[model samples]
Target: MDALGFSENLRVLRKNKGFTQKDLSDKIGVALSTVAMWETGSRRPGYKTAQRVADTLDVSIDKLLQDEALSGGEYLSENELYSRITPKTRNANHDLLEIREVLRTRPEMKMLFSVSKGATKSDIERAVAIIEALKKDRG
Candidate 1:
């Protein structure tokens, strides 16, 4: 896991979720400077803090630790994967490639894709809403 890669990933994921560093700091119960340091690659959080960041960003720890060497590859972190999986991304032309990459990397979601295949648009909407509700409940 590259520290720079981790920092970059954190920054991108936070921005994607429409959160500023201060908002993330507040939510993760960390100092604003601490978040800044982490994002700047000047510091790294402990396991607990890392977990908190991951949970807040709705991503797995592994996503935050992606190898920098693979940055140019087709690999998409869980954060990017979920972003592309969202309904809003469904209409984006680039999202189709992302969705395919996600399915290739995360076999578990294959069932989700298959189940939603023949379903109405409303069914997908309801499912997404349920998932969002579940996330809120967990948080």
Candidate 2:
């Protein structure tokens, strides 16, 4: 198993689920320090323990253990995506929330055509501005 990948994935998943280390430990009946160690890749859990953690996180064991650089493609979790698009400034999350709303309303609309895989922050912001402009015109 890719310990580093697992740790990063676990951190992302835990945050997305709005669980602090203490909360996750409580859910999985583990110590808070255990969760911290897992997130740091300092320790590995047994198979049964890993399965329990996976189940608690509502993710498969494979997802928890797989390296991100699979043959299919690189896996970018939601947190990774956010970090790529915006570096967690105060307004970045608000911008992302608005962009997510646009995406929800227009799922078929592709933002960046040429570069579909790893879009930069400016690319997303530019696309969103265009979309919002068009929306304003229509309204």
Candidate 3:
């Protein structure tokens, strides 16, 4: 039963498991600061690491990362994401979840924001493909 959001749950679970932040980070293959951020609620884990955290803590994903704010429109809208980015494009129901996750994983290539104006869903798909390829290449 998770009464708190992801951060507090992570902290309590880690301590109960007798794992220091450093130890937990080592097991989950993330920087120690990343674990710190998770505990402090400064950041949330993308799909890449959420399951790893849940498994290490012996908790289900629903129990580990469940948060009220997440259910209350944590995801930004296209207008919010592209307001300063490119307002002319507006929004045509562009589900940017995958793109956002990709960008969160790769901050260096944020220039993709430039494509928001007049960017169709097809354009988004193409950008994801390109970025995924880049991810594989770098790995």
Candidate 4:
């Protein structure tokens, strides 16, 4: 949505990776002018080309198109956001899926899930106590 931001982001990422426009072009198999146009906001690349660019830069496509106006707090690239949103598990067991669904709907539960990373039995017991205290307070 923000073409200027995208252009600036591309330029910054390219430079950070020590890639000249020509070098990026060679890596992505695009003409040098195409990379120049993308950086100048004269043109936008297609989705496939954008993916290639992201791969080359080791960034997410969403990062390339990040809009500051729509973001809150620390800026997370698309990939980062996706990773945070998705539950990491070896298998999609029914219980895990159900837990994920509940977390999706319950902000407090989600917060506890994030805060209780590598949770010990005691940590879970403490969290349950805190949640029960809050519930009693509400009652």
Candidate 5:
């Protein structure tokens, strides 16, 4: 969104909450001119103040930054998707290794041992392909 768009959005939210610029400034512990500058598109709040405004407005920081529908909805940008998935995927991979270790000593997996113990060429190729895809998709 443009600066003017951001300004308008802030003003609308403040008005909807029945707050004057001074009232919002007081609530967020900012100077009145800071709020005025934001509303007039002459300046923007710093990250800290932006966060406070989002909290005070009962909105997410992402929503306050961008007024696009996707910003408020389920869609994530490529960078956002990567940032969100990286740690989660790494943790899950660690858990999977632990499961593999546990299964190595489990009698219940004996019947499936032959299939798992001897990897076919196709199985190896598929695993490589999956790894390549994951690497390619990571941003």
Candidate 6:
């Protein structure tokens, strides 16, 4: 892990959030010198302090530590995607879970099908058509 890389990312995020070193230190209850040291890569913060900084900056600890990974847009290979997905998708899964919850509560739009019994052939076909239409719109 590159300490300088992490430091740069932390600095960028802090500035983007309009926080001076003193502002960040005050928010996270650290000394301004400590924040300055961390930002300059002269020293690293402890795990707890690092987490506090991340929280105050509204970024994940992994994101703070591995800034390079977050900045690139290269399409990942299968194994790369699998490894990269775990932590990143933990946040995404929370969003997906909320979507699932909302979808569960939503009344069936396909009233033509008896959902209780199971989707009929026409219902499946219609659902597929709806999905294709949505895909087209998105594209």
Best by TM-score: 6
Give candidate 3 misplaced runs (Cα > 4 Å).
1-4, 68-139
lDDT of 3: 0.73
After the best TM-score superposition of candidate 4, give how far the Cα of residue 86 lies from its true spot, in angstroms: 14
Residue-level lDDT tens digits of model 2 in 1-139: 6788888878888887789999999998989999999989998788899888889889977677767723345777867645544346538768878877877777564444435557788878887799899999999
Per-residue lDDT tens digits for candidate 5, residues 1-139, read: 4566567778877887889999999999989998999989999888888889989988766556664433233555768745755687779879989878867878666545555568888986886798699999994
Question: Which runs of model 6 end up more than 4 angstroms from their true locations?
Answer: 67-139
Superior by TM-score: candidate 1 or candidate 6: 6
- Screening candidate 1 with a backbone cut-off below 3 angstroms (N, C-alpha, C), the clashing residue pairs are none
Tens-digit lDDT track for model 4 on 80-122?
A: 7666443543244557888989999999989878988989999
lDDT of 3 by residue, 44-115 (tens): 888658889889988766557655333333654645544544443334224466677767887665655755
Question: TM-scores across all candidates?
Answer: 0.51, 0.50, 0.45, 0.51, 0.48, 0.52
lDDT winner between 3 and 6, please give it: 6
Candidate 4 residue 70 Cα shift, in angstroms, is 14
In the range 21-115, model 6's lDDT, one tens digit per residue, is: 99999999989999898878899988888899999999977768763533444444657645766776778888988867766676563343345
Best model number under lDDT: 1
Candidate 3: deviation at residue 10, Å? 0.5
lDDT of 1 by residue, 41-126 (tens): 99999988898999999997777766552235568666776674657655674778888988988988988998889999999999
Better of 3 and 5 by lDDT: 5
Which regions of candidate 4 fall more than 4 Å away from where they truly are? Answer: 69-139
> Which portions of model 2 miss their true places by more than 4 Å?
69-73, 76-139
Whichever of 4 and 5 has more lDDT, that candidate is 4
Number of clashing pairs, model 4? 0
